[model samples]
Target: MLLAKVIGSVVSTQKSPSLTGKKLLLIQWVNADGSLPAQDQIRTEIAVDSVGAGEGEIVLVTCGSSARRVFPEPNDAIDMAVVGIVDSVSQNLSA
Candidate 1:
């Protein structure tokens, strides 16, 4: 799983049959501090959301083998999905 922030949304009128109702989104990978890296510093990616995540929301994204767990019937084409919305995050440096 990776941490990402929803930067924007995707509107598609035409798509593959397997993606008929899935919501597409523009997500930007964030650093541990929850800040988006510079364009030259990191690659941005998109994910399909079945769970209604909006822009500016911090989200948890599952990919590859683990991504399938988000949806029981995830087709072969579904590579990513937004699994959860994070309300607050805190890191412990003393651990």
Candidate 2:
């Protein structure tokens, strides 16, 4: 899983059969704590919206096989998905 910020959305009139009625979103990778001014990751990417995430919100992103399972069928062509809308992130690490 990864933390990402919702940049915007993608709208398409014509798309694949499985993608019909799905909301495609644009997101930019963020730090685990959801702080912006990202560390070398300004580029935006796309993801299928599972939760009702909106622009400028911090979200939880799942990718690859895990992303495929976010749906009911689990066999769709979804490579990435926005699973949760993050409220806060807290952690303590010792090394």
Candidate 3:
């Protein structure tokens, strides 16, 4: 799992059958400092939801084989998925 922010959304009318009805969002992975890295941008995939999140929303993303579990078809080709939206974050000891 990784931390990221939903930067934008992807609109694709034509995609794999397994991807049908899934909402694709463009998420940029954020560092521990809550800022995204520019070197190699990381994007997350979000399944269909009515959460109504937008750009700058800190979210949790699960990747790898776990990503496919978000859908009914576990064998779907998915690398990432937004699982939750962060309400707050606090570090006890400053980094």
- Among these predictions, the greatest TM-score belongs to 2
Return the TM-score for candidate 2, rounded to 2 decimals.
0.83
The list of candidate 1 runs beyond 4 A from truth reads: 72-74
- Each model's lDDT comes to 0.80, 0.86, 0.70
Model 2: per-residue lDDT, tens digit, 1-95? 88999989999888766677888999998877666655575768899999999999999999998997888773477899999999887787672
Question: Would you give me the overall lDDT of model 2?
Answer: 0.86
Residue range 19-76, candidate 1, lDDT tens digits: 6777788998887678977878775787888578999988999988666556656355
The TM-score values for the models, in the order shown, are 0.82, 0.83, 0.75
Cα RMSD for candidate 2? 2.2
What lDDT tens digits, residue by residue, belong to model 3 across residues 1-95? 67778878888887777777767778777886688677767544554322456777887787776777766673476767777788877767756
Instruction: Report the error of model 2 at residue 71, Å.
Output: 1.0
Residue 76 of model 1 has an lDDT of 56
